[model samples]
Target: MYRERPAAVITGAVLWASEAGPDAPPTRVLPDGCLDLLWSSRAGLLVAGPDRRAHLSRSAAGERWRGVRLPPGVGPAVFGVPADELRDRRVPLDALWGRAAATLAERLGPSPTATALAAVAADRLAAGGGPDPLAVRVAALLAAGATITATAAEVGLGPRALHRRSQALFGYGPKTLARILRLRRALALAHGGVGLAEVAVRAGYADQAHLTRDVRDLAGVPPTVLLAR
Candidate 1:
C-alpha cells in the first residue's frame, strides 16, 4: 500500500508512505528532478538523491517506508550540500548530518510517519533561509519548455554560468533537466489517453520514435511498457 500528499509546511514538497507487499518485486523509480529524505523500518533514516536515470529499489517484504520528497533546487538548502554531490546515490543521513541525523532517527523511532519527516525538512529548510529563487526560476522555465538560451536570458545569467549553477541546483545541466521534464510531460499526456503521435508533438518531441528513444534512454523502458504499468 502507498499514499502521498502535499506537505503543508513546505512548498512543492510531498509526504509519502508505502509498505512493500510480501510478493512485491523491485520497483522502478523514474527520475523526477527531486530529492527525498526517507525513513525505513529496516534501514533507519536515509537520503535519496537526484537521479539521471531510473533507479530500481528493492525492499524487504512488508517493510514500511516514509519520505519527504523535496522539489528541485529545494534539497541543497535542506541537505546542506550541492545536489550534484549526491546524484545517483542513496546515502545514510548520518553521512551528511552526522550526529544530528542519529538524533533525528531516534526521534522518528521505528515507525516514522511522513508528517514527522516533513516537519524535520521544514525546520532545516527554514534555517537554511530557503531555496535559491534563481534555481527555482530555472527549473520552472525549463519544465515549461523554454529553450536553454531563453531561460538563461530570462534569469540574467550567461550560458556557462547557468550551466554551472544548474549542476549544483539540479544535479545536471539545464539541457538534461529539460529532457527529463519533457519526458515527464510526454508520459502525462500519454497516460491521459492521447495518441502517441500527438503526445510526442505536444511534449516537444520531433516524432513518436523520438519520444520512444528518449523514454527508453532515461527510464530504461519503452513508452508502451511504461504506460502498461
Candidate 2:
C-alpha cells in the first residue's frame, strides 16, 4: 500500500509505501516539479531528481520505501547541489555527498524508517539554511495563477534573471513549473471528485481539451487514466 501526508518540520510532502505481498511494482509516475529523497529497504538512500515527464520505477515485490518530496525552489539549498545537475536522474546519495551521505546513512542505521529520514532532512535543512525567500515567493505567485511576466516583476527580477534562478532551483523555467502546478491542481480536484470540466476551469486551463493536452504531455496519460490510478 502507498500513503502520503504533509510533513511538519519538512518544507514539502512526505510519502511512504510498502508492497502488500509478492505483487509487481507499480509503474506510473507523473511529473510534479519536485525532487524526492528516497530510502528503500533494498536500495538504501537514493535521490530521485526532478522529472519533466512521467517516469517508470521498478522495484522488487514486497519492497518498502519512504520519501521526502521537496517543493520547487527549495531542493537546491536542502540537497546542497545545483538542481541542473540532478535533473531527470535517480542517483545514489553516496555519489553526491560521499562520506556525508555515508554518515547520514550511518545515522539512519540499517533499515531506516520514515521518522529517521525526516530527522536527517530536518538537521540538514537547519544547517544548510532555509529556502531562499525570493524563490519561495516566486513559487507561491506562480502556483496562485500569476503570469510569468507578472511573477518576475513581483519578485523584482527580469525575465532572464527569473529563468536563470528557476533553472538553478527547479530544474526548469517558471513557465514549465506553472504548467506542472496547474496539472497538480487539476489532479487534486479530480481526486476530490470534481468533474473534469470544472477541474479545467478552476485549474485555469482554457477548456477541457487544454487540460487533457497538458495532462497527457506531462503525465503521458489522459486525465481520466491518470486519475483512475
TM-scores across all candidates? 0.98, 0.95
| Local accuracy of candidate 2 as per-residue lDDT tens digits, 168-206 | 888889999899888888999999999999999999999
Estimate the overall C-alpha local distance difference test score of candidate 2. 0.84
lDDT of 2 at 172: 89
Error in Å for residue 42 of model 1: 1.0
lDDT of each prediction vs. the true structure? Answer: 0.93, 0.84
Best by lDDT: 1
Q: For model 1, what is the C-alpha lDDT against the true structure?
A: 0.93
Write down the TM-score for model 2. 0.95
Error of 1 at 34 (Å): 0.5
Which regions of candidate 1 fall more than 4 Å away from where they truly are?
none
